[model samples]
Target: MTELEADCSRCVGLCCVVPAFGRSADFAIDKPARTPCPHLGGDHLCTIHEVLPERGFRGCTVYDCFGAGQFVVQDLFGGAAPSPAMFDAFEVVERLHELLWYLADARSRPEAAPLHDEVDGLRDRVSAAARSPHDVDVTVLQSRCGALLDEVSGLVRAGGPSLRHADLAGRDLREEDLYAADLRGAVLIGADLRGVDLGPADLLGADLRDARVAGADLSQALFLTRLQVRAAR
Candidate 1:
């Protein structure tokens, strides 16, 4: 799954140039879509990367391209400099790769063994679409992946608490037994989660920004992305 992980050294900073950023708690300044960030250097590197959070660009730190940038640059464009078309394709490939990540994770679970074949089929389809992003309907793919993930979650999280999409921001949850809980899409910003055992929790799309996790056990947290971990304090 290393191919699904971001490798900035192999990318040309497409994430810094393609997406628009509004000035907020996460971003230090407003940047229009297709415009390179002011902090981006000529060599395709972030000039303030080491101090992005201190410089008020914490949003940049948690942004994950899921290796889409490098894949598009090296595999699709043969390492050519990014163009307008490449920028457009970047978003599509990113979504495909993200879906691939979840599909791969679902396949890895022994509890989801019954659906492994289906997961593999969908993963193959998503991988094909990543190669020719313009030909695929991403919304349809997302719906399929979401439905399949819901089934897999049911199998893996058997009888666990369903806190899907719950708003728990800034709440203290240190005493909760969240293990194997279905916390998909839960808002946990600034929530106190110290020493919590979150192993096997379904954290897909959960907002964990500024959430305390210093002593939390996330070793087996299902679908927990690097972005979520990085955003949490």
Candidate 2:
């Protein structure tokens, strides 16, 4: 797995226990916070991992903790038995790791060279926060990272369309030139994007559930997480 990808083998099923979810299109049952999912096994693995979607647990299939599960288990708890405190720290560290993922992606972009130093500094702060999550204000750190990411998007996109927060659900956008488009927070559920090249398009928080992406080129999309890709067809 990559640095930002979850490695469940190194975790203690924290995601299955820490967060709550209601019955919806994503999940088939209602689960309370801090309660283990019925499908979690004694070995810290999902019992229905091979057929989670077929078993009405599509949400779990798309969920990505950005490697926070393993980091918290190995680095924070030192492989000790998970505690309530560890569960609480899991969410905080996940957010920090997400910020780090974005910053690391920005730092790697040749177009964002001018801001690589800033990205590196912010990454260092986020890494520290991940180690000591209780002492850090995640909201402030998110705001700082968001501003820098927006600037990086502008530089890389040059003059792409500003469609942030646009509701384009079920729209057929195969002909749209989405190269470097600012699609932050766009509602793209079920949208048809077959064969479209989303080169460097900012997809932060974009909902891509059930979106048709057959033959779509997202190799260079900015801030596109694995969750979004999994949610798409």
Candidate 3:
């Protein structure tokens, strides 16, 4: 996942500044975009990094920009301290890069062979746009990705525990059996998945924000990333 996953050492802490969040079970307090988090130090390090979850900032741990921060800060912003405009651009670019992540994942699926060429073209366009703030178009990218995800989902959506787009939000599913589940585009916001065995479950485009997963067994979860896991408990 080199250059496709987060490489914070090559970043400028854009994740802590370019995004906004409200105080909740997942976050300690509210923060606005382009404004640094209170726990963010002068050196751009998270002051509560070591104890983020314990300090009520567990949301900070699951966010992955898929190299968007590093690419924006180092390549696009030229390694300069980000301005408000830069943050705005980063917001749009971040979404585009997220599509690249999904597209890349789709291309890796042998079941998606028919769409491989299209996925490659889309991935290249998104990757190139991610390197230039002026070229990132959020609306078009989202539409394209939506269509691509639908097409790819058809290829992988077999009969194992399908839960696509199911409204399971805020439900406590701790220690449940979710192995080989089809969880594409599922709304899992604030759902509890602690100790839930997600063996080989497909989680493409699953919204796991604020879900509890303290002891979830996701070792073999398909398309599950550190960023997705971090967004949950």
Candidate 4:
């Protein structure tokens, strides 16, 4: 696995300081961007890190910058705490890095093997851009990644089944061969999808609420938004 993992231990707590949130179920208090959290100690660590949910900081639990925080702290700025400008710049880099993850992850699939070099080359460029992302044009980077994904989608969909706009609500789709299926707007609420091979499935707008995902692999799925997952159990 890529060390592209989020190792907050190696970070200067950028996530803790950069984002603002209003009081809600996920947050107990409002904090502005670029402002340090009251819970953040001078050591750049969260005082309630171990018990964030208990402290009503539930939003922190699901947020993953996917190693961008540490990369900015240790690699770009040499382990210094972020200045306001640098902190703001990281938000952009984090978004670009996220696209890198999907691209890098796709490279691991047999379907994407032929595009391995292209994938790696783009990944390298993205990593380099992240090191000094200040004043960088992320739009260009996003376009490039989007183009590559468009090409890769075809290869990924080859020989895979599609269930475009199919209604499978509350159905048992366990161990089904649904690779590369176009499941746009599919109502999958309470569906039993355990052990399903839904590789590269088009889960765009698919309602996955209360759907059982144990042993289910949608890692290669396309267009699966965060909103869909959040709606699921």
TM-score of each: 0.98, 0.98, 0.81, 0.76
Q: Residue by residue across 156-228, what tens digits does model 2's lDDT show?
A: 8888888999999999999998888999999999999999998889999999999999999999998888899
Instruction: Give the per-residue lDDT digits (tens) of candidate 1, residues 71-132.
Output: 99888989999899899889899999999888988999999999999999999999999999
lDDT (Cα, 0-100) at 107 in candidate 3: 82
1-233, model 3: which lDDT tens digit per residue? 56767767767688998788998977889888677887777777788889988999877777778777777777777888768767877787778777877787778778779989988988888777776668556788778877886677667544467787888899988755677688878999999988888866778778988898888887756666667776776
Residues 142-204 of candidate 4 have per-residue lDDT tens digits of 888877865676677775566656789899887577767767578898999888888788675
Q: After superposition, how far is residue 87 of candidate 1 from its true place, in Å?
A: 0.6
lDDT for 185 (candidate 2): 99
- Model 4: residues with Cα > 4 Å off, grouped in runs: 159-177, 182-195, 202-211, 219-232
lDDT computed for candidate 1: 0.92
Tell me the lDDT of model 4 at 14.
88
Q: Show the colliding residue pairs in model 2.
A: none
The lDDT per prediction is 0.92, 0.92, 0.78, 0.77
CA RMSD, predictions in order: 0.9, 1.0, 3.2, 4.1
Consecutive 10-residue window with the lowest summed lDDT within model 1: 153-162
Error of 2 at 25 (Å): 1.3
Task: Find the number of clashing residue pairs for candidate 4.
Answer: 1
Runs with alpha carbons beyond 4 Å of true place in candidate 3: 159-162, 169-181, 189-201, 209-222, 231-233
**Candidate 1 pairs with clashing backbones:** none
